[model samples]
Target chain A: MNDQLIALFITFILVAIIVVIGFMSGRDKKVRSSVEEWSVGGRNFGGLLVWFLVGADLYTAYTFLGLTSSAYTSGSLIFFAIPYSILAYFISYFFLPKLWAVAKEYRFTTLADYARGRFDSKLLSALIAIVGVLMLIPYICLQLSGLQDTLQVAGKGYINVQVIVIVSFLLVGLYTFFSGIKGPTYTAIIKDILVWAIMLFMIVSLPMIHFNGWNPMISHITKEAPQLLTIPSSGPKAFPWFITSAIVSALALFMWAHAATGVFTAKSANAIRKNAMFLPLYNIILTLVIFLGFIAYMVLPKGTNPRFALLELIHMSYGGVAQGLAYATIALASLIPCSIMAVGASNLFANNIYRDLINPSVNGARLTMITRCMVFVVIGLALLFGIFFPTALVSLQLLGVAGMVQIFPAIVFSLFWKKQTREATIAGLVVGVIVTFSMYFAGKSFGINEGFWGLVSNIVILLLLNPFFSKRAGTNAIKQFLFQK
Target chain B: MRKVLLIILIALPIISQLIALPFVNSIHPIIVGLPFFHFWLVLWIFLTPLCTWGIYALQKAEGSID
Candidate 1:
């Protein structure tokens, strides 16, 4: 068989195995009886499972694609990815334990659930949920683009990439709908293992194949394209941009609904803390993984779309089964996180929007059914966005992160500060989102990320409104939250 | 002591990026195939977890693991 056929065969078998794993994950457990169990594995996950679940949830195919692409095009600015994640783990170490405790006490399923309980405002929680679901659509679409890019590399001329993306996400949507969070938790283990193996192989072997050694490869690139190895001083990605981007991205990372869902699944606050302590080890591998982008830049021809650089290099270096393995890895990376995001989005819809506002009397089982159905709706919407407006994927994802950063005041800060009123938080979120969007359109980097400006405005509004709002019962809620342990 | 340790654990990663990067932003003195800036970041990437583990140990000692 030809190279394409070999790739197609390996990818086909791997996809089949992943799909089977998805369907079989929740079979031995009891029936998912409520939105709680369906969305968060009944909140009984130990540290190791929560680690894989969040690892899979946070590091999407975009993580691999986006990081290497940054390395290929930008340079040392790629350092933003690692530091942000390290800071995210450290920050979450402090707060996630507390958040997990309160979430468990209140039986919260999503971040929106926590906001409502903590702030005593269902309207604020509903707004948080709307931003979450809206932001996640583009994120899910980004994963679809990852899948689309992988299939394009693997299938070559034989298959239509669009059909493959639709079918693959359809398979993901089905299992997520059937098994909910359990499906992604099990598949995450497989996905993480495959990603590690393939990435390590490419990282080690590609440099050897091109320049005979890693050091030689870097030295040669340094001699030829010195700018690719050094950090920038001015223009779009300068030092200030890196600092602000790292800080803002770290602040926003765990604020995403899917990440919060992962935290809520842990069996205890200690489990979450332990998981955070060790999470940086994953970033060590991630820091090394971006070297693949540098290697690709050194070897591949100029002007290759930085996004496609890594796959194209693999196809060039190892023509047949190895190429298939890399493509299969990327595809699984996309699908695994797609499953987690579907559960996160659906839970927000069922618990916060539908049950909270539309049908106040909805039972737990009925809500589970609604969440499962909403999983399809979420996937369909993502699919529509992925197909019709493919070019908007990058901007939408950046905007999604900025938009998500707006919620930090509502969900995370409210856990600590007692004086945070619902109205103040709502204003901060609204104004912060507007600032983030306007900054993006007006071409006003001003040496920092737009998300930082959004966060600044968010905190500003919160502080400006703090003194005006008199003491309320919410002050006691923080005391209760602290003394509960 | 716990508060100092927690602050160190969180601040170490951020300080490394915002302070250390611009200070050591150069391509020379390539250590083990990586530039000085890359070496600095990678070294701390491995170290940040140790600081985090230290914080976790303190939390456990205080009986405040949560």
Candidate 2:
């Protein structure tokens, strides 16, 4: 067989193993009779399980491909991911444990659930849920793009990439529908192990394979592409964009509903805290992961699409089996997180939209089923969006981060600021979202991330109007929420 | 002490940006084949967790953890 066929054969075996693992993970877990069990894994996950789940949930295929691509195409701007994630873990260190506590006490399954109870407003909860689902759809699509990139590189000309992409996601969707959080959590272990091994292997081998050594490679790149090592190298990614994007993206990281689901699954507040402490270890590998792109910069010809830089580099460097393993890692990166994201979005739909708004009388089993079906719907929408609107993938993903960060004022701030009223928060959210889109659409980041600008308006509105609104509404509800501690 | 470490943890990421630490962003001092800026950030990625562990340990000791 040719290299493509061998790679395909290996990929099929790896994917089959993942699917079996995904399905079998749900077998021994508690009977998922309710939406809670399916959505949050019965909220009994220990530190290691939570670590794998949240780590996989946070670091997607996008992190693998996108960072390498950015580092290849642009310069030091890709460093935004490192500090941003570090800041995210730091910020979550303070709030996630508390959020977990409140979530457990109140039986909260989604961020919207917390918003509803915190603000005593179903509209606010529904609004948060709607925004989450909307933002997550594009993120899910971005994962599909990640998978597509891997398949395109690995399959080459022998396999129909589109068919495989759709079929692979459909398989992931099925397992997610059947197994929910457990599916992803189990698969995450395998994915993380592969990711670590592959990343370590590449970090060690790629430099040696391409150049004589690391210093010579650095010297060669510095001599040839000096600007690749610097920031603002004739690109839109200025220093201000780097700094503000890091802050906003960090805040936005845990705001995703899937991230919230990951945190909620932790068995204790201490687990969340401990996870935060250790999560950065995973990120260290990520810092090393970017070296793959730097290696690509030297090996690949100019004008190669940066998105395909990493995979193509692997294709050029390694044998069919190694390439298959790398391809499967990226594919699993997409699948594992997509499963969690689907579960998260569907939970919001079934709980916040259907139960809260449409039918309060819906029982638990039916709710579980609705969430299960909504998993298909969510992934289906993302797939359609990925297929139809391919060009806008990067922008939509950025906008998703921008839009989701707008929820910080309503969700994170309310944890401490008991004086924040639903009116003020709703107004802030509306204004923040509007400002985020307007700035993005109008091409006005002013060198900072568009989302940080939105957050400014969000906080301003909340600070200005919250006192006025909360006095009339009274802090009784807010006091009740705070007193729940 | 925990409060101070928490503040430091939150501030470290932005402080490098806000001040534009010249010594950190330069390319001359490459540690482990990484630029100073990259190395600085990666250093913090490893350190932030230690800081977090300190805060967690302190909080646990105080028995204020919930």
Candidate 3:
């Protein structure tokens, strides 16, 4: 057989294995009895499982492919991912434990549940749920596009990439419907192990194979394209944009529904803390993956599509089995996260929007059913959007982050600040979402990240309006929430 | 004093990443065959976890993690 066919065969075999693993992960029927169990693995995961789950959930195929592509095209701008990840863990080190404790106390399946219970506002909960589902569409699309790019490189125009993406996503949707968070949590271990092993091997060996050594590759970049080595001091992706994007992206990381789902799955606050302490080790692999982009720059011919830079490089360098294994790793990277994202988004919709607003009388089993079914809807919508728009994956994912970060005031602030009010949070979120999108569309953000502008406006409105509304709202529940556990 | 130390530990990674960017954003004085810009970030990828580890130890000692 030819290289493409052999690679495609191996990729399919690996994909099938993960799919079976995903299904078997939900073998315990008790997991499907309640929304909480299905959405967050009954909150039973220890530190290692939580680490793999959050690692797989946060670092998607987008991180693997899009970061490299960004490195290839825009150079040092992609390095924001490293610092943002570090900052995210630092921030999570403090807030996630508290959020997990409150979540445990209330059986909160989603962040929206916390908003509803803490702020005493179903409307705010529904709004957060809606915003979360909406923002996650682009993110899930990012995973689909990442999968699509991987398939496109492996297929080499012989296979129908679109059909494979739809089928793969449907498989993800099915397992997520059956297994929920457990599906991804279990499969994530295999995916993370493969990702770390393959990425490390590629980074260390690829330089040796292509350019004789790491020093030679650096010398080649310095001699040929030194600009790829440094962030520009001016322009849209200048130093200010880099700093703001890192800070804003870090702030927004946990706001994503899938991330919160990962956090809520931990068995104890200590598990969450320990995971935060160790998760940065994954960033070492991520830094290596970003260097693959530089390797692609040195090796791949000019005018190659930057989106396929790393995949195409793998195809060119490695044999059929190795290339296929690498492709499968990327594919699982997409599938595992897509499943978790589907669970998180569906939980938000079912618990916050459907139950709280439409039917307060819904039973636990039925709520779990609705959340499971909504998994298909979320994945289907993301598949559709990804097929049609298919913009630059990194920017779209960032745009999603920009919108999701608007929820920081509503979610994070109410954790510590006793004076927070639902009215201010609601109003601020509305304004923040609007400003974030308008700034994105208006095409001028004065060299700062669009999310930064939205956050500024979001915070200003929160502070100014919070005092006025604090007098009317009661603080007893706030005190209870603070003192819980 | 512990709180101040914790705050500084948290700030160390962000400062090294953002506040110290311009000074270290150079292609010269390559360390281990990497440009200073990339070297600094990669070095922190390892060090930032140490910072988080410090914070974890402190928090554990302060009875925050039990």
Ranking 1 against 3 by lDDT, winner: 3
lDDT of 1 by residue, B1-66 (tens): 778877877677667767777888888899977888788778877787788888778777888652
Q: Rank the candidates by TM-score, best first.
A: 3, 1, 2
List the candidate 3 regions with Cα displacement exceeding 4 Å. Answer: A392-394, A476-478
Which model is ahead, 2 or 3, in terms of DockQ?
3
lDDT of 2 by residue, A1-485 (tens): 88777877887898889999999977865636777788888889999999999999988999889889888977677877887887788788878877788788888999999998888888998899999999999999999999888888777777899998899899999988888889999889999999999888888888888887788888787788777776663347677787788888889999998999999888898788888888878888778777778888878988999989988898889967888888888888998899999999999999998888889899877888898999999999999999899989887888999999999988888888777799999999999999999999999787779999999999998889887887677544444756656
On the 0 to 100 scale, the lDDT of residue A331 in model 1 is 86
Give the poorly placed runs of model 1, Cα more than 4 Å off: A28-31, A472-479, A483-485, B1-10
Q: After superposition, how far is residue A406 of candidate 2 from its true place, in Å?
A: 0.4
Candidate 1: TM of chain A? 0.97
What TM-score does chain B alone reach in each candidate, compared with the true chain B? Answer: 0.78, 0.68, 0.91
- Backbone clash pairs for candidate 1 read none
Candidate 1 to truth, TM: 0.96
- For each of the candidates, give the backbone clash count: 0, 0, 0
**Residue B40 local lDDT, model 1:** 77
Full-model lDDT, candidate 2: 0.85
